[model samples]
Target: INRLSSALIRTSTKCINALDALRSLKDGLDQHPSITKEEKERLLNFISVARQEYDEIAKKEIQKAFVYSYEESAKVLFDNYLDNIEAYCNSTKLKDPITDEEVSPDEKLMRSIEEQIGVSENAKKSFREEILLRLSSYARKGRKFDYTSHERLREAVEKKLFADLKDVVKITTSTKTPDAEQLKRINGVSAKLISEYDYCPVCANELLKYVGSLLNR
Candidate 1:
């Protein structure tokens, strides 16, 4: 049961991290072509704050959910992508800071999907496939691969993941763990990120969006 719980938590964290990546991408798009110097500075400010908020959220989520071995392994990949994103966002700001009026929720989400997933056409498809892959791993058990039972288990798994995720954010202040060596290995290759970006950009982006939407539960 403890292992199961940890697996579920890791699954949830992956979903959240993926979603946040997409969200960051969307924010970049929505704020593109800063209209003025002031706008650019404002954009930078907003991004800094958003990045801080995102980092904080990720730390809490990961610490609480990744108590199991599988989760810890999975997070190495997630952290690598996040590290890249952090670099990307910072680079963008250094290039040209800008802020615009609020963007629509849908547009924001779309851009997020694009950035976290990828700007390339094939990269996006790979992202969706990765999500499915992780979902499969999370939902898998060592028993005889029972489809009916698997489906039911997935539903329950999702439910528990969300419940704990929400509780951690609401009831606790923060949760963070250090595993620098593990992170180094996971981020070193970006195996998971590459797997997700293996599909066509258009299809992959759509798939990520669809999967992220389901995470609302």
Candidate 2:
């Protein structure tokens, strides 16, 4: 059961990671001005399809893990039952029946044990089926992506503008040192670009300094 649980966790992580990668790719497309609007739309649609497919795959993996765990649990229970029955029979030295046609004590005990095991297995199977039905229903519900989507969009915009503004630095450097207003414009553009991406102030400052150095060179 522990091993099966771990497998399920690993499977879920893999699915999440794959979805994250697709999301990152979509964000990159959104930020790239070189990519046409139509192409971006097509790529976004592809990502959507990939997400749907991954969701289905994750559902199936969860179901498979549950089924395997339950089956293993049943087998362990059955084995423990057999071990307990054997111990009981060994501890109690019961003889065979006096009459040749009569059933022996050991035979009777084996029959009872088998009947009990059958009952337990049936109960487990019914319970497993019920849980699976509930899981299927739960999986059909929609999930929220607002927070993640917003973050990805912000990051994409930041990356796109940063690349675009690199050219501005080069152009300014080709001429003499930029005046106060020119520097202000450059700082404004950098600030606006990083703000959209939600970069921390320290990181944004460092990025601006790097760009300033490039312009000075």
Candidate 3:
């Protein structure tokens, strides 16, 4: 529907609900006198099928859970990990951002991120060193190193972030009636999708359920 709306009908698709667009198209077809009855009927039939498909999928997906895209949250975690990873590889301590205490680099955390892109335990040192070296180079060049600095690292970071959030996303999305905290979080996430991620409320909620179902499976 979204693709048809944008590419075929030239409707604004992003943040504009697909169903709404289909309905609007149906209305236009109904009113436009120049379009032949046969063509109108054929298009209307297509819209009906599309609407049914959308409805059936939405009914199934409404209960599933999802998180924001990689740019929204994953890189933030990746950068923080980068800040402490070198020390972790060096067998030293790093500061905990939340607790303001010296803590060891979490081997599990580092490996969890690296494992997503097929980094092996034996090669972990070289990966970390390469990342850190790039970080230094970026700093010297008056720039910032990020997931975009390394392709595999970006994939790893995104995959790790999605994996790490799976359980929480499942809980949040699958709940029919959330508690106060959950409701707040849901509203905040939805709002962020609308404001920052260019999703309309309809698509945003639909996306949450879609990802939620994927995680459950």
For this target, which candidate reaches the highest TM-score against the unseen true structure? 3
What are the RMSD figures for all models against the true structure? 24.1, 28.1, 8.9
- In the range 109-137, model 3's lDDT, one tens digit per residue, is 88888898899999998999988888889
Q: What's the candidate order when arranged by decreasing TM-score?
A: 3, 2, 1
> Candidate 1: global Cα-lDDT?
0.38
Over 4 Å off, model 1: 1-34, 68-217
Best by lDDT: 3
Give the C-alpha miss distance for residue 17 in model 3, angstroms.
Answer: 7.8
Alpha-carbon TM-score of each model against the true structure: 0.22, 0.27, 0.54
Model 1, 1-217: lDDT tens digits are 3333333365434333333454454455454564676776676677667766655554433332332223443344333333333334334322212455432223232234344323455554444344445545656754432211334323333333334444432322221342664444223223322353343333333333343333433
Score residue 214 of candidate 3 by CA lDDT: 58
lDDT of 2 by residue, 1-217 (tens): 3333333365434322444466566656755799888888888899899977865553333222222323443344334333434334445433323644533234343333334324354454343243334434555665332211233222322333333344654454233467886566545544554555454454444444444444455
- Local distance difference test, each candidate: 0.38, 0.44, 0.71
How many residue pairs clash per model? 21, 0, 2
Better model by TM-score: candidate 1 vs candidate 3: 3
Candidate 3 TM-score versus the reference? 0.54
> In terms of TM-score, which candidate is stronger, 1 or 2?
2
